[model samples]
Each structure stands twice: as structure tokens, then as C-alpha cells.
Target: MWNPHAYLAFADERGRPYFDLLSRVGADAPRRVADLGCGPGNLTATLAQRWPQARIEALDSSPEMVLAARDRGIDANVGDVGDWVPKPDTDVVISNATLHWVPDHPRLLIRWAEQLPARSWIAMQVPGNFDAPSHRTVGELARRDRWAERLRDFRFRESPVKGPLEYADLLADAGCAVDAWETTYVHVLTGEDPVLNWIAGTALRPVRSRLTRAEWEEFRTELIPLLDTAYPRRKDGMTFFPFRRIFVVAQVN
Candidate 1:
């Protein structure tokens, strides 16, 4: 039920962290590259451009995203990223802003690090914004009134991506050389209720898909004002959305 258009509305802003994650990958030349959770494949296509000499492919669990990616001429498949296995000669595995959605990602990262061939590279980026005001209010609001019953179980959506040091240690234990860090992107968003528009593409989807049309609109009415206050507009009417993300690049050796 992922709306590609909604996800891509903040394409430029959403893309910056991916690019930052990509830039940190140490492999100068790779023979095979895979982008896990390569939503819409727009960024994955860039991987082909960056390493035209390499074989590149993208994987997303959403059929809609996979179809859109294939339509754009990128080799994309609809498959769970968590279930992916690296090809024997796979040189690099780079995932951008996607690992957070995979349940128990830290355990998955450890297993991938242990299994991938020595000297191969694994680079990943995941949003670390669970406690941020934008997301906190969702859980807060879900606990009240009519929302409490229909949306009672909705709060488990908080991403399980761990802190930078934890990933660093896991990769190190798996005999890889790891570089892990955190970055907080303060995105200045414009247009009407841009923050709503932003999360609607992502974090809002769980509630959106489950709620009836009337319930969704009623929820939006209550949520909008909270978002407005949580993320105040500047004089120029731009909302600053501070998002934190964790990045890990491990070269198994």
C-alpha cells in the first residue's frame, strides 16, 4: 500500500542521506552491487551510473515500488530485503534508509557480516528518529479517545535500528573493520503542512492503511495541530524537521 508519489514528494530531501551513505562506501570499484530496500529504485539507478562497470540490482518488498523501478529501467525485484543473500562474488551491498523497517535489523546485520565473504563490503543507512517529536506524538495520540481502541496496537512501528556504537561492536565481533556514525539532518521543508506531507509518505502509512476514510481524516485533524506546534514554522514559513540517522560501513576481513 505504499504510495510511490507520496514517498517521492520529498525526493530531494529524502535523497540527501542516501547520497551521504553512498559516498562513504570504501569500495572504489565493485564487480557486483546490490541495493536492499531500494524503494522506487531512483537511487539504485544512480548506483549503476556510479559503477557502470559493475552489475547492479535493486530489491524492494513493495510490488508497487518494484514495478516502478523496473519501469524506470533498473533491474529491481520484489523480495524481502531481510531475506536476501549475497551472490558468491557480490562485492558490495549498500542499503539506504531501509534497514530500519526490517525487524531485528541488528541481528540481521551481525549475520550478514558473519556470512558475507571476507573482504566484501556492507554499507547501510537507517532512520534513527523514534523518539523525535514527530514520531513521539504518533504514539502519544494513539493512546487516547477513539484512537486508543482502533489504533491501540499501532505504536510498535518504532524502528529497531540501534545506536552507532552497537553496530560498530557487532561488526567488529564478526571480524569486520567497521565505521559507524550518526548524523542529524535538519531538513527545512516548505509548502503547506510539509511535515505532514513528509511523514505521510512514510511513518503515517501504518495508521493510514488501517483507518477508515472518515477515521483517517478525523485523525489528521487532530494530528495536524500537534505537528504544527511540535514543529513550528519560521518567519519564512519553513518547518525544520530534525531527523537522525545511523550509518554503518563494514568491510569484512
Candidate 2:
């Protein structure tokens, strides 16, 4: 359901969380690296640059994404991150902005932490924005009037992304040195309906994929104005979108 072009439209902003997650990963000179949910492979290419000699690999669920990434000289395969199991030689594993879609991903992390070899690391980041108005409005509107029944089968907005403490304890209990924290980035966006444009690339994807062209446009009509009120344009005509994300980096102890 991911359109590579649409997802990459706000590439810089979407890439921020990936870079932030990578910045905290302390693994060095890894023998092998695996990037889970490596969408479009733009950020995964950086890992290749950082460790040219390492056996670097990437996986994503979307064939289109894998194809796009391969075009960028990144070796990516279409595979669900949920079914991924690190090889014994994998020294560094990373998943950014993609785990929330997998049910019980925290448990998945714990299992990986328990099984990884010494000196190995697992780092992940997921958007912690279910409670934000951008998301609330979308869920709210979907449950009203003629849309509720239509959208009944498309519900998945409230993801199971956990808090900093939950992740901290999860990895620590699994015997890894953990660093977990949250960051709310207030991105100043320009252009018309900037907030809508931002989520259109991400949070709005499920709804967009399920709705017809006419239905999507109608939904957009309701969504954009609500987003305008939720994230009012500043005097300089830029919309400030506050995005919160949670990051955890775990190195096997």
C-alpha cells in the first residue's frame, strides 16, 4: 500500500527520525548489518557508506520500495520485518519509523535482544503520535456519519508504540545496555496545507489506500481544514507540525 513517490515527497522530514535513530546507535565496525523496514533505501545507503566492507542488507514489505531502493544501489528485499530473524553474524540491526505497524513489536524486540550474540545491537524508532491531534482528528472523522461504516474495516490508527520507560525496561530486562528516549520535533512546514501534505506521506496512508479516489478526495476535504485548525499557519505562513517519536538503542550486554 506504500507509494514510493508519495512517501518520499517529504523525504527530509521523514528522514529526520531515521537519522536521529542512527545517530544514537553506538555499534562500530560491524561484521554484518541488517536494516529492517528500510523504505526506499535512502537511509540504508548511508549505512553502506559507513561500512562498505560489511555485509549490509535491507528489507521492506513493499516491492515498490525494494525496487526503488535497488535503483539507489541498495540491496533491499521485500520482506516483512515481523518475520525477520537476525543471523548470528549480524552485529547491527536497525528499524526506523516502521515497527508500529507490526503487532507486539516490543515483544519482537525482546526476543531479538535475548537471541542476539554478544556485541550485537538492535535499534528502533517509531512515531509516537497516536495521541496527537493530527491522528485524533483522522480517527474522529472516520467514526462519524456515512464514513464510519465505510471505514470500519480499515481501522489501525492507534498503533502499539510504547513509551521510553517501557522500551528501556524491555531491553534492559533482556540483558542489553539500553538508551531510550522521546523527542518532539516541531517541524516548520511551508506551502499550502502543509500539515496535510506531511501526514499524507505517512499516517494517512492506510485510509488513502482503502478509500476510492472520490472518497479520498472527500475525506481530504474534511481532513485538510481540520488540520489547518489543529496546526494553524503562522504569521509567516508556515505550519508548525509537532511530531513525537520514541527511540531505543540496545547493545547486547
Candidate 3:
């Protein structure tokens, strides 16, 4: 139900933060790599370009996204991240802005740490803005308003996330050499209802899926007023929506 095309519009906005998260790979040369949740494969293609000698495979659960990625000539496939495991002797596993979707990710991280080769890297970034107002507004409106009668269970989708320390500790416990940090990214999104537009492509999918088209429109309409107030329009007619994201890089030691 997540409109992958609409999400692509904000991909450029998310690029810088995700790239910064990946810098931990440093100058280490990797022979092969995999990109989890490689939406449209734009960034996945960069992995191929950076390590032209490396075998790069991009995977996502969305068939639409997989097709888009394949059309770009990247090796793309549809797969569930929760069920994905590292290939033996794989050199690098790079996941940008995708880890938050999988529930109980600390355990997943520990599992991946155990599977990846010694000296190889596991790098990931996850949106950490679940407690922010942009998200809070959605959850509040979903439960407090008239729509609450029917969509009572439509709550904030739980993400498997922890503070930077939590991730570092998990990796350290697993005998990984770990690096972790958080970043606040102010994504400058164009047009009205920028925050709504951003979530429409991602988090709002579950809510959208539960409602009729008219009900969805009504929900969107009701939600926009709240977001506009929460995230005021800039002088340039764009909205600068701040997003906090967690980054972790662990190398099997």
C-alpha cells in the first residue's frame, strides 16, 4: 500500500544522511555487497559504481520497487528483510534507511553480526523519528478523532529501534567492532503538506490500506491541517521537516 513512486520524490532529500551513515565503510575494499530494501536501486547502483569489481545485489519486498531497480540494470529481487541472512564470505552488507521496518531489530542485528565474515562490515540506518511530533500527530489524530471508532487499532507502527548505545552494546556483546551514532536530518521537501507527503509513501501505508478511498481522503484531509500547523511552510513555500535517524556499523571481529 505504500506508494513507492511518491516515496521516490523524497529520495534525494534522504540521500545525504544515508550516505553519511555509510562512510564508516572507509577505504576497505569489498568484493561483493548486498543492499537491503534497495528502493528503485538508485543508491544501489552507486555501490556497483564504487566497487565496480564487486557483485552487488539489491533486494526489496515491493515488486514495483524491484522492477524499477531491475529496469536500471541492477541485480534486483523481491525478498523480506526479516528473513534475509548474509551470504557466506560476503564482504559488505549495506542497508540505508531501511532497518526500522523490521520488528525486534536488536536481535536481528545480533544475528547478522554472528553471520557476517570476520573483518567484513554490516552498516545500517533507520529513521529514529517515531517519537517526534510529525509522528505523534498522526498517532494522536488516528486515535482521538471520529475515525478512531473504526480505526482504533491503527496506531503508531512499532519499529525495532534503540538508542546508539543500545546498538553498540548489542554488537559488542556479539564480539563485533562497532560504531554507532544518530543524525538529525532536515529534509527540505517541496510543495504543500510535505510531512504528509513523506509519510504517505512510507509509514502511512498501513493506515491507508485499512480505509476506503473516500475515508483515506478524509483522513488525509483531516491530518493535513495538523501537520501544516506542526511543520509550518517556509518562506520558500517548502517545508523543512527534521528527521532523526540512527546509524550503526559493526565489523565481525
- What is the C-alpha local distance difference test score of each model? 0.86, 0.87, 0.83
Provide the TM-score for each candidate, comma-separated.
0.96, 0.96, 0.94
Q: Write down the lDDT that model 3 would get.
A: 0.83
What 10-residue stretch in candidate 1 is worst by lDDT? Answer: 152-161
What is the full ranking by lDDT, best candidate first? Answer: 2, 1, 3
lDDT of 3 by residue, 1-253 (tens): 4456787887777677767877788535687798998988878888867788888878898899888889889889999988998888578888887777777777888888888888888898888888888888888888875778767777574444788998898899999888999988787778767789888888788788888999999989999999999999978797888888988988888
In model 3, which regions exceed 4 Å deviation?
157-159
Clashing pairs in 2: none
Give the lDDT of residue 50 in candidate 2.
81
Q: What tens digits encode model 1's per-residue C-alpha lDDT throughout 35-116?
A: 9988887788898788889999689999999888898898899899889888887889988888877887778878887777
Q: Higher TM-score: candidate 2 or 3?
A: 2
TM-score of 2: 0.96
Per-prediction tally of clashes: 0, 0, 0
